[model samples]
Target: MEQDTLDLAHISLRPFQLSDADDVMVWATDERVTKFCSWEPYTSKHAAVDFILNITTKFLWCRAICIGDRAIGSVSVQSYSGDDKARAKAAEIGYILGSKYWGKGIATKVVKQVVEMAFVDLPDLVRLEALVDVENVGSQRVLEKAGFQREGILRKFLFLKGKSRDMVMFSVLSDEIGA
Candidate 1:
């Protein structure tokens, strides 16, 4: 799918631009923001620049979660790699919001929009999943509020920061949405 922008009541989801580096660095470098994330806290703007240039640019579905003119976070739906067509139809969703926006329901709104986009814009998509660190109750609430069902725990699913961690697997199927 082509890169597209989405407008919600309070936020706009748009493609990341070179100018977004500084704003991205604001949260990306914060220890509080990276604590439950898979990657380490970005130590410099250069790292955020590299991420915007390499990773975000490679995915058409990666979006900067913006409030008005500023980007405060990101959301993405990436298809897993596999030769099988069925595998290609399934994608994983991930998101991060700045700590200041944690309890205002922004994540849930962003997630619901992205999930709708996945089913409507990406015709091949059949399933979308999110794996949240088991200890992150806020993120778990966000996923559940967005209509994702907690399937199970993926034991030692990821090596985040410096140690292996368990993740709670959550998913929302196309047919299961709005039902």
Candidate 2:
């Protein structure tokens, strides 16, 4: 399904534009922001521009998490299984927010919206999953608040910042959301 701009009370999920490179760099370069993320901290505006031009543009389900006209973060849903319709429909969700916007419940709000869109608006999707760094308590709480149940830990599942890291898996099924 096409991802249109999603409006929320304090933030909006919109397509990333090349002009947002500066705003994106504001958070992308921060060491704290990339501490637990899979990608290294962006070292220049060119890197941010490349991300907008290359990565975000190629993914139909990725969006810039915005407040007003500023792009502060991103969220995406990716198919975990290939084009096999008979398999249980599933997708993995991932998100990141500028540290300044953290702890304000914005992530939770964004997650809840994505959950609704996945289970209610999209009929083919039966489950939505998230893998968060074990040290990221804030994100863990956000997933729990959004009604995703903690499934288990994925040991050395992701290599980030030059080291292997463990991740906690969480998921919410369509029926769990009353879809």
Candidate 3:
């Protein structure tokens, strides 16, 4: 497939809708897209519906990455709850793009947008972090290019797909925005 430069003007981030199910499936069911994600590649449309209606609703802030009116992927900032005061001031950002859109500078651009949006939308938020699988170089690069600092790695931090994995920790503080 011949890759073309994606016009940034065409990219957008908006709240997810049930109508986006078909477009969600375009990436949610692709292993290449889900390889580094915590969830498995969805096997059915019902799962996509479940995600849009159930899963995304739980996020502090979530949006479908769109081109025109079509959902191509998602980006979110999830807050850590409970009585942990330290965790309350921070949120974790997560994002995924369609496999066809990989290497087109889409994820990096979207991540940068999410960082700016998250900080403005969540006033109490002092930090935005992202955890990437050690093997997912593309994702790490995306975070770095978006201005997140590599804080180091967490060994065996998460058990996914039947194995414990090491993850790289990256973060950008609210004061660091545009710095």
The TM-score values for the models, in the order shown, are 0.91, 0.88, 0.96
- Cα error, residue 108 of model 3, in Å, equals 0.9
- Identify the candidate with maximal TM-score: 3
- Candidate order by lDDT, decreasing, is 3, 1, 2
Q: List the residue pairs that clash in candidate 2.
A: none
| Cα lDDT for residue 39, candidate 1 | 83
Candidate 2 residue-wise lDDT, 1-179, digit = tens: 11233345758898899899999999999889888877889998999999998987654388889888899899888775566665548888889888888877789999998888877666888889999999999999999998999999999998877788999999999888854
TM-score of 3: 0.96
Candidate 1 ranges beyond 4 A from true positions: 1-8, 84-86
Clashes of each: 0, 0, 0
Cα lDDT tens digits for candidate 1, 40-144: 889888998898889886664899999886889999888874676668878999899987777777899999999998899988788899999999999999999
Rate residue 112 of model 3 by lDDT.
91
For candidate 2, the TM-score is 0.88
lDDT by residue for model 3 over 1-179, one digit each (tens)? 23487787788999999999999999999999999888999999999999999999999989999888988899988998568887999999999999888888889999998898889988989989999999999999999999999999999999999999999999999999977
The lDDT per prediction is 0.87, 0.85, 0.92
